[model samples]
Target: MEWLVPVLIVVALVVLIGIYLWATYNSLVQLNVRVDEAWSGITVQLTRRADLIPNLIETVKGYAAHEKAVFENVTRARAETLSAAGPGAAGIAEGHLQQALRSLFAVAEAYPQLQASHNFLQLQHAFVDTEDKVQAARRLYNGGVRDFNTKIKVFPNNMFARGLGFTEREFFEVADSGAVSAPPRVQF
Candidate 1:
């Protein structure tokens, strides 16, 4: 009877450990998926904003025909932002796009008539809404990255995470907030 009790205890311990390992692995996998989904949300929002750029540029062009540099910069930035991959590259590309947009709008400031145009007004509202979504998506993405990073770095979970291929993620950030070359102030 004494031997039987010890044997059963050992088996219970082994089973408990197995269950714990399985649970931890599942949690890590779920978190990894969340991170990926969050990043996709950001990409979707950015693409939405990018799609709006052409119409905005054309509307501004009618009034600021001489602002060739601003138009080119916006166009180039939009392309770069669209092509950018990963958080690090995407964030830098987006910041450049933001600056370019700010300058474009600043140029728009000179044309009161353009600002008053129905098309311009509608585009402005759409851009603002998309930007808001982008900001929200960025926050959600960063949160997911933070969660995944934490899971892969912490005790016990880290051990399982390593074997499971879970790894830390980079947060999306503006590379140079204080850069003298500022993006245009994008909002109304």
Candidate 2:
């Protein structure tokens, strides 16, 4: 029975290793899904904000008909924000969009009547609410990425993560974090 003892020990070790791999793989997949959901949340908020832009631009345009450059810049930035693909691309697009929006708000400030219009006021509130949601979504996405990256990089999981087709996720970050983190200050 000497050979039998060695054979049982080998089988036990193999089974333990198999269990570890299974658990690790499942955890990685779950984390990946979470990250994807968080990203989708961010995109949904961004799209809502993008939809608000045209109305905002039109409202501003009604008052400041001569500010063609500001209108065009805002439109271009909105398009970039809509078409942005990944976290890195989205970050850059967000910076441009924020700058364009600041310029648009600056134009609005020059026209007190535009700032006082009922439609402009309502749209401004909606945009601010959507911007808040967008920031929250970005925080959620980055948090998910942090958890997912930690999972794949930890302990024995690191050895098998790559082989299992798991990799670290990128955090959603903007070029000007301060600008994006806060709602644009639209002074009335």
Candidate 3:
């Protein structure tokens, strides 16, 4: 009877450990999936912005041919952003692209024709909307990363998290404070 009690206690402990591990693994998986979804949202916004850039450039090109430097900067920044690999790299590239786009828009302000053009106006609106969506996605992704990182860094979860090969995720950060420092100036 003494041996039976000890045996049952061992079985109960095993079951409890199994439950804990299962729950922890599932929680981590959900958090990772959320991060991925958030990244996808950002990617969608980026793709939309990329698609709008050429039209914007062309519209401005008609009236602002003398502004070759602005056009070239926007083109180069777009290319770099498209080629960026991960979240960190992409964020930096995106910041550069946004700054370049801002400069391009600033140049456009000097050309009344470019600013008045329907195509330019539409493209600008689209880009602004996409940027908003991208910012929102970044926030969501960072939030998910924060939660997941916290999970793996806490006491009991930390033990299992390390054992299960769960590692921390990097936050999606913008390198250019200028891109997000203030609201973009838009004029109708």
Top candidate, metric TM-score: 2
What count of clashes does model 1 give? 5
Could you give the candidate ranking by lDDT, starting with the highest? 2, 1, 3
Compared with the true structure, what per-residue lDDT tens digits does model 2 show for residues 95-181? 989989988999999998988899999998999899889989999999999999999888988888999899888888887876666
Q: What is the lDDT of residue 12 in candidate 3?
A: 100
**lDDT of residue 10 for candidate 2:** 100
lDDT of 1 at 44: 98
lDDT of 3 by residue, 30-98 (tens): 998988888788788787878788988888888879889989999998888888877889979978887
Model 3 stretches astray by more than 4 angstroms: none
Model 2 ranges with Cα > 4 A deviation: 178-183
Give the Cα-based TM-score of candidate 1 against the true structure.
Answer: 0.92
lDDT, candidate 1, residue 29?
86
Each prediction's whole-model lDDT (CA)? 0.87, 0.92, 0.84
